[model samples]
Target: MQLEARKIGFYYKKNRWIFRDLNFTIDAGEIVGLIGPSGCGKTTFGRVLSGYEKPQEGTILLNETPLPKRGYQPVQLVYQHPEKAVNPKWRMEKTLHEGGEIDRELLEVLGIKQEWLSRWPNELSGGELQRFCVARALRSNTRFLIADEMTTMLDAITQSQIWHAVLDIVKQRNIGVLAISHEAALLKRICTRTLTIH
Candidate 1:
């Protein structure tokens, strides 16, 4: 998977531009970090890259082509708030099942047992909830992942676990990861390549 953004412009409100004529390209087998001050549209940029939001101008091309808005395609997004990422009514199993049937091996890597899979989102703690969210995102078939502050709510140890897991996924799958965050220390810890936005 390859993502290229050129001269893109976006904004949430009047007279303020989040990204203007911004440009970057990430090839397969690479991890790109997007960092900036708060509300500089780092998450917004991640959304546009993942095809979850539209950019006011410019485009996000995957494999040298534009991505369709709807399909059984890949490229999953794990947002900052796990509460919003996973359905409150759905069980953990339901979350991982979206990409397909559950992979037993992945659960082991995430240090989660099958029992917890049946529980509702509310049943899990913040860290656990986000981990399950990661599990679900990994089940997708896409070769790229946009993680927008997905581990911000967790403790240091939990954050470490999530970051390592994500990096492991990237290495094993040979996929590109676009990790968005305002935490410079965290981004530097995981990203082989990083860029500051705005």
Candidate 2:
């Protein structure tokens, strides 16, 4: 499988393009890194690729077909802030199961505790909540993952652990990953190749 973005363009204001005429691709099982300075529209491009936002021009294709309009999306996005991703009203268990049946092995690998499932979003630490977010994005139907600064806030050890778990699952499932971050060393360490926006 491959995720391709062709001739993409986006803008928030008239005559102001966040990015335009962009093209990129990520083949299955590839770890691709996207790096640029802050406010460079890397996250916006990730959103467009994941179908969270429609590009003003061109198309995003998954293996030469348009992204699915309904049902579970093949492309999943795990954003930087897990707190903002979850529902404040729902318990951790509900949020985790939102995508589908929870995989026990995945939960264990992500270090998600059984007791944390009953707690609210505020009750868990950022790292714990991010584990749920990451696990939720790795559902059976997910073909590609857009990790937009996914672990920027975590401590070094926690970040390493999460990345290790994510990479393990990516290899096991052959899921393509578009990792967006400003850390050059991280990109060099994990990505097969890196693309710079500017």
- TM-score (all chains, Cα) for each model: 0.92, 0.98
Report the C-alpha lDDT of model 2 over 107-161, residue by residue, as the tens digit.
Answer: 9998899999999999999999999999999988899999998999999999999
lDDT of each: 0.80, 0.94
lDDT of 1 at 182: 79
In model 1, what are the clashing residue pairs, if there are any?
none
Kindly list the per-residue Cα lDDT of model 1 for residues 1-198, writing each as its tens digit. Answer: 687887788877764878788888888778778888887778888887788777888988887788866765467788878888877887888777875775777777877767888899888888888888788777747678888888888888998987887787778888788888878888787788898876
Clashes of each: 0, 0
Deviation in angstroms for 95 in model 2? 0.5
Best by lDDT: 2
Worst 10 residues of 1 by lDDT: 67-76
